[model samples]
Target chain A: MPATLAEKILQQHCDEQITGPGQIVRCRLSLVLANDITAPLAIKSFKKMGAAGVFDKDKVTIVADHFTPNKDIESAEQVKVCREFAKEMGITHYFEGGNVGVEHALLPELGLVGPGDVVIGADSHTCTYGGLGAFATGMGSTDVAAGMALGETWFKVPPTIQVILTGELRQWVGAKDLMLALIGTIGVSGALYKALEFVGPLASTLSVEGRMTMSNMAIEAGGKVGLFAADDKTLAYAAAHGRKGDKAIAADAGAAYERVVTIDATGMEPQIACPHLPDNVKPVSAVAGLKVDQAVIGSCTNGRIEDLREAAAILKGRKVSKDVRTIILPATPNIWRQALAEGLIETFMDAGCIVGPATCGPCLGGHMGILAGGERAIATTNRNFKGRMGSLESEVYLSGPAAAAAAAIAGEIIDPAKV
Target chain B: MYHGTAHTVGAHIDTDAIIPARFLVTTDPAELGANCMEGLEAGWIKKVKNGDIMVAGENFGCGSSREHAPVALLGAGIPVVIAHSFARIFYRNGFNMGLVLLEIGDDVSKIHDGDELKVDADTGVINNVTTGQTIQCKPVPPFMKGILDKGGLIPYVQDRLAERA
Candidate 1:
């Protein structure tokens, strides 16, 4: 009766006794999520399907993060649609305007997701909740609609890949580098149609926020979800945010994994994913001195308070290069408030960085900071796919917050330690 | 048989490349269609004729959970897509939208741009008139077959809920 963590969590949802990968079963969901860009479409579908109301208003969540603060008339209309729908449905977890933050970060910050929960969001980064030992994955808006009305949907249990991490990461190297290293090792399609299970000594040591960063980019590897054991750190994070879980969750000892990949974290330096692909990774040393016109230090992937603190620590007494326009976005309002409380905001302001509100802006090239033709940016956000942050000719270099902060100071990509 | 002319692209054509974030403002299919693949290559939509089959190397539709990616393709007159593989989200999105996606593994390379292809959705059989080859696609499971028959997930869910009622 042994099963992978994903299999166990999925089974718990449907109470299906026997199943394997590739077999579909209908499972209940702990949370059904959508956002400004996606919720409008889902609402349309929910109406098209003739559903008068949601299965459970409390379980449904809508966050206006993407293209929000009303980027344009069109995006404004999209948010309005979501707003009206949430109002009409009397949805408990609707977030917009001042309350809005990046969905993945805000959801975990609110403790809306915890161990053993099955979550599906219209945004791909929904899998970020896997940091709390939840089985979360992204679905299309249409899928979210069906899930909202029915409170359940079909799931194909994915095979698991055991990612064994050993040794400790060197200073200035952290979760983003580890994940970028893994994605580089696996290519973009390396973990397609599979769940990634993180284990080994290093897994227990990574902070919950760092683990969230690790799980946030699971989609970058084409993974169904990325999971860690619900150990003490996870419980503590949950409790701090007002969630309670009775027990820890982990894969059964004899659970099956389709593949085993080991990543040696010792002596590893900061990693960067170059232009066009996340799997197109290189050690920071490999691509030093690449000029950066913009340095963005936020997104759902690397926009937590911890990430900002790392950037602040580097920028404390230093100023960003006059040639570089550095932008920092704290992921949630609480994180933003915390950063303000800790005076990280003052450090960033003194260092010449533009502090923006908690929106997924600039990360998706929606607004805030856009790249011109032939311009390049060094960012702590996930994904460097071609033209992701602006002009098709504009290049994006993905890095950890330290490298991003250092790049802001140097006006080019460089080793953080050297700065 | 679903028939179309082929248009082949290389590997890892991400969702951002399929439809950029800037064009995601509307759920209108035509709006999404006009900007389809504009992120990867300009003038991509102009290349499509009605009922054209888009072919690609591995991991087509590899980023984001935007159903808009597949919706854009369908809106752009690409009713069928044959690729060596697909990322998890796009595969599900395509099926959920009732778009035909056939996984032909490496045999997808046998199809050249502008090749005439007739694909059988039920049998996973592909006939390439340009190469004179018969290729087998990765078969759809019976459960997913039912969803496709129902014209995607919404209609399928409606029927299932009706049965329960």
Candidate 2:
């Protein structure tokens, strides 16, 4: 059987010879990840297993990205659990404080993950690695503990859905807008338990960062993973990040697809997902001029250097509206330093933006910025679920950095092209 | 076999609705259960009794991969969740936390809120005692059944390691 990119990768990792969907396979994981929020529970489960030690210390990476610096006493204690466990276990890749960022962004930049690898993380956005042609999925803490204990886990191969992107994006439109439009068309649960393979001209043209933005939100559409084929762009990205031994992973010419959807991106407008559901997408033209109390431009989804540059271009000489508070977070410390070197940090500060540490921050309502009652925000994050950024009554509008930056200046949602 | 009264919800009841982000500060299952479903329908935790069943439309437990979602439901005494389908992570998380989940497709509409249900894990049959209607569900795969039988993946792995030793 001709295999999709996801299936082809899984076949290599599967303990059994399987080439099709729905086959139960035990896969040897190349990497297992857990963050401060999930790792403590995973360590507890690992201890409960009474395992002498982790299956492979080098393959396990523990990061304190969420609630970093500790939000409160309870959060501090939770992180302490991970720190002590990592130290005692002698985990080689443990990262905290200045070295930490959103795990999804930090891991790839550090070359800890690459194509054809089967990775599992306790964080749901683990699917982000699929941008590099890896078969990565999120599991629970206990499941991650099992992976740590046994170095392998089981999966029921999922059918594949091909999303063919044609034509080029219009000015001011990027992957965030494209992904929001795709999710709106598919609805939240359209691809439940399925793999989404992004292909065709537009997908191929997307930068590695753009592909990460798309793959990171595959979960928003209830997809098991969103995959992009490894090409020159992918190999170059891996090489730039110090990764060697990059392999090309792609779907066979006649791979079976359960369904195919083609999106024409020619002249596509910047899009936004309205509060409460990621699928509630509308073009910026539709919701423009709605007042916003805050604007955020960072998360695992859109906190890469490319996203920062886009936002900096829009906010270069303009000041944020006095009525709105704008918060910007670089996804990783390295991205932060790069932004500083490029003077993007100074430009943001001149625009009345508050640039914070590289952390999940307000994206998870953990800390740094929290919306008050009845407040509204525009953010470049994957999720805008109710109370995702603050008070349950507060609303979040999801968009690309351009739209988010424009919203900060206007104190309301606006079409970036019209800016 | 287990019998329970059903508490129902609509499609896409996400994990944020199951246990909002504000309550994710602790890993204690009991602490989480006290506030489960507070985001969607307030005071829902009070309504859930031991052995009560939850029925919902498609994509139940969608959104963040917080294990707290299932741990809270299990802690709140929901023995099983019957939905049209489940998001992948939540399905696996539920099993890892020892929560039983059934995917009943279109048959989900036949079961209503407050309906009494008897679920047989071995046969994958759900009997709506209130309406006296029976709906068949996909049986749990052998490997997953073994995990559930052992009370979740942690114990399952521990037993496997013990056997090897």
Candidate 3:
């Protein structure tokens, strides 16, 4: 049977030919991840299984980013468990505290992940690794522990739904626009349990950073993983990051697709997924000029150095709107340090933006920027599902960092192009 | 072990609601389960009982490939989860973690919390022990049944793959 890119990959890694959905196959995962929150659990499970050591120290990556400064005693204690496991397991790519940023961002920046690999993280957004053209998704601690105990996993092969992007994006219509526009067309559950195999000429045009922004939010669209076919651009990105690995591979040109949706970027204006649901998308014009209480620019999705640079450029010399509280959080401490060295931090501070520690705070309602009743904030994070950011009634508008910065200045939904 | 009647929710009960991303930092499944539904419908934890059934809407375990989701639920003593559908990963994770997941159609709405239920694993029938009502759920596939019968996916896979040798 002709199979989609996702099916083809799953079969190759499996011991047999997997035909339909829900057929379990013992397959090999290319990458496995754990952080402070998940590592402790994985380690606990490992102890229960009486596992001697991790299956392959190099395949598993443990990163410490969620509680960078060790927010509380619990977070501080979580980091301790992760560190001890890294030492005991002899893990190769263990990222120590403060040396890393968001687990998703820091991995690629450090050149540890690459194309065609099946990456799994204990964190939900581990799907972010799909930006590298791999089958990366999130998992739980026992699963991570199993991966450590035995460097393999079982998966039910999923069907592939193709997303073809054509036409050039208009000015200020960045990757965030593409994702929001997609969610607009395909409701939140439209792509549920399907692998999003992004294709077409326009897909190639997206910069690595931009592609990461799109793939990071695949969860919001209810897809298992968003995949890119490895090409020259991916290879160049791999080289630029100094990743030493086999060359990446693209999908066969005639790969089968269960469904296909074409997005004309030129037709898309700036978009905003309304609060409470990522698929509740509309043209920014529809929601523009509305009052906003906060604007956040950071997260594994758009909190890269490049994202910071773009945001600082917009925020420089501009005062944050009196009614809007602007917050900037670098994805990782490394990105934070680099931004400070490059003066981006100073530029944001001069613009009256409040900087936050390198953790998922307001994005997941962990802390740092919880909203009050009826408050609304524009953020660059992935999901805006109800109560995802703060108050169930509080609205969260998802966008790129540029739009977030611009909105902070205007105190409403201001298009970056206009700013 | 679970002690009481099962409660049901609609399909697509996502991992974010079952166990939010904020709790991904810790691996202790029990601790994570405590805050599982705080992000979704707060105070849902108090309504559950050990061994209670959870009937849900479509696409249960719909978000994140996180394994903590099923672990949290299983550790919370949720004996079985019946939904219109289950997300691919969560379905696998639940079975792998020894949690029972039944795919019944919209009939899941027929079952409610505090209804004494008797589940026949061999027959795949949920009897409302209190109301004498019965809902049909998909029979567990033989392979998955073997996995569940043996505790979880890892042990099942380990045994099956090892036997092949």
Please compute the TM-score of chain B alone for each predicted structure, in the order given: 0.94, 0.91, 0.86
Residue clash pairs of candidate 2: none
Best by TM-score: 1
Arrange candidates, best TM-score first.
1, 2, 3
Which digits, one per residue and each the tens of the lDDT, describe model 2 over residues B1-165? 989999999988988889987777788888998898987877877987899999999999888888889989987888899999998899999988778899999999999889999999678899999999999997888878877778778888888778767
Worst 10 residues of 1 chain B by lDDT: B156-165
Q: Write the per-residue lDDT of candidate 3 for residues B38-123, one digit (tens) a residue.
A: 66787787777777777787778875566778878876767678788787668767866767777887777777756777777567
Candidate 2 local Cα displacement, residue A219, angstroms: 0.9
iRMSD per prediction, in order = 0.9, 1.3, 3.2
Sorted by lDDT (best first), the order is: 1, 2, 3
Q: Comparing candidate 1 with candidate 2, which one achieves the higher TM-score?
A: 1
Residues A268-383 of candidate 2: C-alpha lDDT, one tens digit per residue: 88999998899999989999999999999999999999999999999999999998989999999999999999999999999999999988978988898899989999999988
User: How does model 1 score by TM-score?
Assistant: 0.99
Two-way TM-score contest, 2 vs 3, winner: 2
lDDT of candidate 1 over A273-377, digit per residue (tens): 998999999999999999999999989999999999999989999999999999999989999999999999999999999999999999888899999999999
In candidate 3, clashing pairs total 27
Where does candidate 3 chain A have its weakest 10-residue lDDT segment? Answer: A244-253
Which lDDT value does model 3 have at A254?
A: 72
For model 1, report DockQ.
0.82
Candidates 1 and 3, the one with greater TM-score: 1
lDDT of 3 by residue, A108-159 (tens): 8877787767777877777776777777877767777777777777665677
